[model samples]
Target: MLRNMLTRDELIQWMRTELPRLLQEDPAFRAQVIGILSEALVSKGELTRLLDELRAMREESQRRFEAADRRFEAIVEELRAMRADFERRFEEVDRRFEAADRRFEAIVEEMRAMRADFERRFEEVDRRFEAVDRRFEAADRRFEAIVEELRTLRSDFEQWVRFSQQEFAALRVRVAEMGIGLGSLGLRMGQGLEEVIRQVIESFSGAGPLKAARLVLIDEAGELYQPGARVEIDALVTDGRRFLVEVKNYAKTDEVWAFHRKARFAEAKLGETFEKVLIAPAATASAVALAKQLGIICYTFRAAESRETSE
Candidate 1:
């Protein structure tokens, strides 16, 4: 059954595997192959040659096997050398890594020292700033104290100025009072001179009203024009040929003009024409001129004789 299942290539492969063993152990089958070669005209020399070639081929295959074995052994020895070199290089790399780790640790230590120094410097700077702040505070206090002193000084200066002003005002008032008192004394002396001039007129004229010394105020009750508004006549005669007179220590233009106005006002009140007269111990030229313009008589007294203008 097994021989029947064998294909053509299987039968050939089976013969190839068993053919050499059959040739070596089976002498009869070998002899049969030889007989067939002889029948095909294979001579003894040819057989000898064939055997020598086969022997030679076996020797060559044996030499090639020995060369391949030597090459394999050399390759194994080269791989072992490469492994040893790789092991030495790995040991060097491990040493370098350890040195690098030591360097990193040293750097870390230096960094920590630097950090401590920086912290100490920062603390000292903070203290310096605090000291400056205190100094500024002291300076501010001193400045405020100076400001207060200036304010006090200014207040005192103002008070002194006010006191000076009040004192000056009182002094001016006293001076004015003294001037009024002197003026009242001068008026009394002028009135006495007026009386004396009236007596001189009576003696010179051989007198009727002049002998009476008729000195009067125009409005004795102050009821003529306004209350407390009255003018005085040093000498007056109202009976016949009336004369309205005024007396002055020194006759000025203003006094002459005022006397003229009083005469007019008195004429309006009494409705009578009177001669207007002005008498002065000393009279300005302008006063004499003004009195003449108003058609009044002016008389000035000299030590020698009386200076009079009849016109």
Candidate 2:
């Protein structure tokens, strides 16, 4: 019973080592042991049952292992495919990054060009402003020069006006002095003529069959006389109509004929005939002859008579 109840490893060892020994011991013993072993086999049928169960478990395990192996192979193939996809995506990302870099470089170059253009425009504007400032300065200088010239011209004009006024005043004074001198000379000549005529009339007053003698002088063409000259006789006298004396002061021999003619014209104007006498300090021979032919009396004080009268 103990032998039959052996543990599984022990029972497998007994079957391997002791089963042959029991058979070599006797034939009849072997047959009897075989019969007993058949009984023991009946009793130990748990081993066969265990073996069948093991076989069933092994087949199930093998099917499970093969299925697991196929699943692992499928998982490995998927991982390889995922690696290939990742490599392709990485290349595409690199290409995108390179394009973005080129665009960024282009933008930087455009900015640099804009900055250069702005600098050039600023310089041009500065130059134009400087030129405008210079023109303004020149205009200011010209205005100042014009003002200075106008001031000088005004000063000169004022001086010239003053000089002209002074000169005009001096000329007016000179003209007035000349007029006064001429007036004085004319007055002196008139006075001298009056004195001589008065002396002659006094000398002749007592002589001559002339009882209350008359004196007359006439001036014709009086307009021809010089300014301030006396052409009219200073004295005129008249008695009863028997005789008429015409007296003239002669400064030139050429004037004697003119005087004689004027005296004769007066006789015709008097409307009554009368004896005529001419009196003068000097007369031409023709004047004397003409007087005689007309039966006109003439008189002059000789040097001897003049001296005798003075003594």
- Top-scoring candidate (lDDT): 1
Once superposed on the true structure, which residue ranges of model 1 sit more than 4 Å away at CA? Answer: 1-195, 203-227, 302-311
TM-score of each: 0.31, 0.28
Model 2 clashes, total count: 0
Structure candidate 2, residue pairs in collision: none
| 225-299 per-residue lDDT for model 1 (tens digits) | 465555766666444556787767677788887888778877877788888777666677878878899998876
lDDT of 2 by residue, 154-257 (tens): 89988998998888867654443343334334435653333333334445564322233224334344433443334332233334434455554321223444
Clashing pairs in 1: none
Q: How close to the true structure is residue 248 of candidate 2, measured as C-alpha lDDT?
A: 43
lDDT, residue 240, candidate 2: 42
